[model samples]
Target chain A: MGTGTGLGRVRGLGSAKKGAHHWWMQRLTAAGNLLLVSWFVISLVRLPNLSHAVVTDWLSSPLVAIAAIILVANVFWHLRLGLQVVLEDYVHNEASKLGLLVLLNFYAIGAAAVAIFSIAKIAFGSAA
Target chain B: MSRNHSRPLSPHLSHWKWGANMLVSILHRMTGVGLATVGGLLFAGWFFAAASGEESYACFLGLLTVESGAINIVGAILGIGLTWAFFTHLFNGLRHFVMDAGAGYELQTNRHWAIAVVAGGIIATLVLWGWLLWPAIMGLVGGEG
Candidate 1:
């Protein structure tokens, strides 16, 4: 193997893959979370009481239901992205970093799923 | 491999620009932790209010409202924390959007936008607090009659 050939290859090289999609998603989810969070806060403040029936009634509204779903999804997505960056920055051990990243993704997904399911049950089920 | 190993690796941390991106990164984590803590507290309050009787719920409301100045202080802290979290996340989210659209990559633009984020956060917090307090002020004056 000649050194000259390897040098030429290195000079012309780019990354083995692209990460634009991931970057785009991180931004998109952040934007979504921003909007959802504002709605969530305002809605919470507007709620007159914390009675079960009242809570359910508010959630059962079509607009509130949709916003809650989006809020849950975007929250989880943003959490995953933020945690991934923290892991990448602080964890030098590749194996550990990857493991934590996988775990974080699963946790975020599970939490969001549970939240959405609870909201749906409260909003659409007989409880409402 | 031997020759490559002889060269020292460049410091990864050194390349990061200690400006808007860094600030956003740190704020993201801070707000995340803040949200989690506040969310947990809110959830606990919900659970307590749900499980307990109306008396307990009334007590909770009392603490949130007609209590001593300490309660107001706590409320203010939470309100400010929440306001900062919201605005920081919002501005940084917008920054991410612009970056995604292939703008603001230049150094000067990046710094300019970073400063804007800081300013936006302050202004947003002030406006939100002002709005929230307006009702309280009206109530205070109205009650004096």
Candidate 2:
């Protein structure tokens, strides 16, 4: 028998040292979501119109555009982290879990990319 | 290294009575999944429409919140559902982070926080929609008077 304690023997068998980083990032992004989402909700409420031109015009503002980008990025990252914990806890099949996790990452990245691209298109496109 | 049969297998839902805390925890995960999947798709669509041009953007707006019609009814319901999901998940997630910081572990406090998350989420959604519809409501009132 190894001299190490029971938990010590089993610890490294399941995971490495990087587990804390996921927890930390989840919390950090949660805080970011709180702030950015508050801004988003309040901004939407204040908008005078939801019409295409007016909405796009509002998004064109530099600060709004940057904040919107950051909000979507942080929101999606936080979302992915949360879903990961659920999947890890519930998924019994190793291969299936791995497949779903890979898909989740791509989905989040792709969704965030589309949102950022749309914001950029509006913010930088011709004023007319 | 032999498997210890004495260790109880994974705890299943049937083994324990359902409680408010458990419900909130389950909902937190469920909403997170919903937001990532369904919400993400609509979000991509919104951005794509905006980037495409004014006509497409108008169509997207019509698809979501157009006033008065069958499509409007369906879109409104989906919009409200999405809004509620967003608020509930956001609030409950904050509560989870707070608990992670080593507080609110007492049974009473845990239940209270769970209830707060539920109630607060509903109220937040209502107030947001109320603000969004305030002008329309006022317009109706003005016309009636």
Candidate 3:
């Protein structure tokens, strides 16, 4: 009884082979976002005000600087994941969906890179 | 027994997969709600800082950090809730992308992944809080000396 047939036996049976990779990526991003968001909130809370000097000073700290960079990157990456699903669900046209996905990834990656780079320059350039 | 179109019995929740896809769907909604709220708060913070002088900004800061106060309480609640929303959404969102790629549809594997996500979220939150609060703790200790 156990030695069943061919393809029919596997139809809608078990694991979706690729699902674990998605699961793992989601978990990884979640973990990263958790750390980044917490740091961002606390840092924002501690900041004195909108004063340019104060804002710069807050951002100048090595810890805050690095965290900010990470936070921005994580945020964009997370946003990409979210918007991808929204696009997939709503945009029926295959071309449009694929285009949106590509645009989202490009925008996220570019924005994150810029944010990280700018923060790094501001935080470290003065010293050098 | 002619045709009856009322509906079949609902499956037990416990027996349901409650797996990656389900988890991701739920988290997307949760995070959307959270992000909306947080976005408002964020803009408000900026507005307050811009409008009032340094003193007012300081007051806002004090309200957030001061112990045993309404503002602090609200801050704490938002902090935890937002953290959960962010982590859950991020993790589950990634899961959705992977599913789009056609993966992880196994029953047993899905269950394990769901459990892992929840556990991972909790642990990550704790670690983040610890890192963020360490400086404040050190400041308090130094002040006492």
Top-TM-score candidate index = 2
lDDT of 1: 0.68
Q: Rank the candidates by DockQ, best first.
A: 2, 1, 3
lDDT of 2 by residue, B1-145 (tens): 3447888788889988988898898888787888778887887778778888988987877876655522377677877788888999989988988898899999999999999998887998899888766767777789642
- Per-prediction DockQ scores? 0.22, 0.68, 0.05
Query: For all candidates, what are the clash counts?
Result: 0, 0, 7
In candidate 1, stretches whose alpha carbon ends up further than 4 angstroms from where it belongs are A1-18, A46-53, A126-128, B1-25, B32-76, B137-145
Q: Where does candidate 2 stray beyond 4 Å?
A: A1-15, B1-6, B67-71, B134-145
Give the range of the ten consecutive residues with the poorest summed lDDT in model 2 chain B. B65-74
Query: Docking quality tier of candidate 3?
Result: incorrect
Write model 3 residue lDDT over A41-121, tens digit each, in one string.
666767754354576567667987777767776666666665666677678888888887898777667666655665665
Better by DockQ, candidate 3 or 1: 1
Q: Each candidate: what lDDT?
A: 0.68, 0.83, 0.62
Name every residue pair that clashes in candidate 2: none
**What is the interface root-mean-square deviation of candidate 1?**
4.8
**lDDT tens string, model 1, A1-128?**
44664566567567657567667677787777667777777887688755555666776777887788777778777667766777787888889988988887777776676667766665565342
Instruction: Name the best candidate (by DockQ).
Output: 2
lDDT of 2 by residue, A14-104 (tens): 7777969998998899899889988987787688766677788888989989988998899889888887888899887889999999988
Candidate order by decreasing lDDT:
2, 1, 3
